[model samples]
Target: MTFSPRRPLTAVLLAGALLAGTAGCSTFSDSGRSKYAQGEGKPAEDDDASASASSSAEAELPYDIRPLLHPDKKYYGLAAKGAPASMKSVKEFASSTGKKPNMIEFYSAWGDSYETTLAQNAWDYGALPFIAWEPFKRSLAGIAAGKDDAYIASYARSVKTLNQPVAISFAHEMNGFWYSWGTKKATPKEFVRAFRHVHDVFEKVGATQVIWVWSPNVINPMPKVRLEPYWPGDSYVDWVGVVGYYARTGPSTFPTLYGPTMDQIRAFTKKPFIVAETAAEAGDRKPADIKDLFQGVEKRDDVLGHVWFNFDKEADWRISSGPASARTYREQSRSSRYGFDVTKP
Candidate 1:
């Protein structure tokens, strides 16, 4: 999801200059290697843990598909029971459209208020579980900050109770200026420390029922120099997820938005990668744009899935829901961009 213009504007202006200097290499010595290691343990250990987790990592759906946030607007408390026709349609499409189960993102705050609604709906709908939980927002803000300790603990318990394999994404988008985690003047080391600290807490608490997801924005449009300080070591992250989107205000093509960051992070880590959140505006966003985004990176074996940012605010000026988006997506199936036919490729 794109951040409000108020904060990201400055980041955008600085991107070009930063890209030019990515050529000069920076050393990640003491800060990157020490301190945080004490609390989170050695990166080697985390790496081995992640590797073992991968060997037996629960098998993913045959074709990658995450429905993003709840389709039923009701979960947002914006619709009454059975009122979101669009969401309902998308749910049916995902379940019946293919043989495999489709995944969906479950935002953390929403969990407190809408878990029952989502759980009930998820059970009935046959939506594959790719649960994406964001607990870091409240925690880092000092709002939740481990106080209830029992709160996230309870949330983890609730998720585990669901008995579905899920991916818990805490404080994602760490590499971008939009989120609170990345907003401060944090060096990569500091970011790494903060990231590991949170994960360590989860591990200490015994929340292994879920997979750990470390997601960051594709290379910030800002230059490389400014971006280097954000690379927390590759060891701590289990699955590498990236948020990439196409909008009129930004780059014209999907690949332009996703390519560089996808390539860079892929080079840095061996973990499975996901286009965690992605979409193109409906009207202004040609079906071709969606195809292009996937087309560019479809070949990467490391690339595992694509979760559309089915939010309504960032529209293509035409469609307001997933049904319309899916139609446009299928209509353009003849193109190379439509490489996700579950039956074949």
Candidate 2:
């Protein structure tokens, strides 16, 4: 993430409740169903009338899943971390960038009864939704054991309503020691089982519109907890997303920061690679770092895309934090390879 939850580690927000109710619905209430859309753990029909309206979306149904993996197209996305998850706000943020993001990123937590409002809006705006689903205050083992099926099923149906393709990444950065699912607190077995279990439920409920992204934090800093042991395999993933940043000062190149980790990932799967979260901290080389970061990834044929973390915390990571940095980004995005062509409804 561009920024993390301050309480992901020790916060047990769901202490006595099995799940959040209407009182805590997420940014998905635009359709009024996110609040009352309950799952009895069974597939429910939306009726002939609703289905008729959805027929158009259904025809547009199989939503183009190729852009994310197009062999010749390079996709560029954005993650406005800590910002409102509404489409209106998302558009305003993108407008400020002088470039629109092909994908808009949002966040969700385990047992957090949320809806797909952002996803719907992103689709309407021709942008793919990239959801960063977290497993806070819960153990991976419990999720893998089918304890979270009802919640997962409900989410699946909601996406089914979306009727457009969306990308879902669960427990991102599992190898990092900050969250409960990190290597120090959970085993690789638990992580793999939980991921497969969630994907299986999504499959069972017929939420095939989803594009699964197996995301992990870079391992150059922690070789002991290699990302390979935690991978759920090709059949379970459609994309390989990695998160790494240039947090230091002085001049540096992209390979210097991400080459070794990318090499390690190549040792495993050939899934399309996405720099799910990346930024250059405001330091001695903030301007140069931004230039190298964009140019470096732009030159890689194997990189499907890159998402910039547009936030102003923990070292002014926002592109506008520095004038030179912002200018470089705006100019670089003018390239034809910085794909902004999205599918709109």
Q: Choose the strongest candidate by lDDT.
A: 2
lDDT of 1 at 215: 70
What is the C-alpha lDDT profile of model 2 across 1-345, one tens digit per residue? 324545331111100111211111112221322212332232323545464554433242233344345535566677775433555645655666666777777778787754566666666666777888899868999999988899999989887666667788899888777678877789998999999999999889877767898888766556677878898989999988777776664226788667877888899888878888777777667788877877887788777778777766545677878788877777777777776455511
Q: Write the per-residue lDDT of candidate 1 for residues 62-152, one digit (tens) a residue.
A: 1111212211111101111121222564544343333222445545442363264564354334333344444433435342234445555
Number of the top candidate by TM-score? 2
User: lDDT per model, in order?
Assistant: 0.45, 0.68
Would you list the clashing residue pairs of candidate 1? 15-221, 15-222, 18-223, 18-224, 19-223, 188-229, 281-316, 282-316, 283-316
Q: How close is candidate 2 to the true structure, as a TM-score?
A: 0.80
Model 1 TM-score, all chains together: 0.61
Model 1: lDDT equals: 0.45
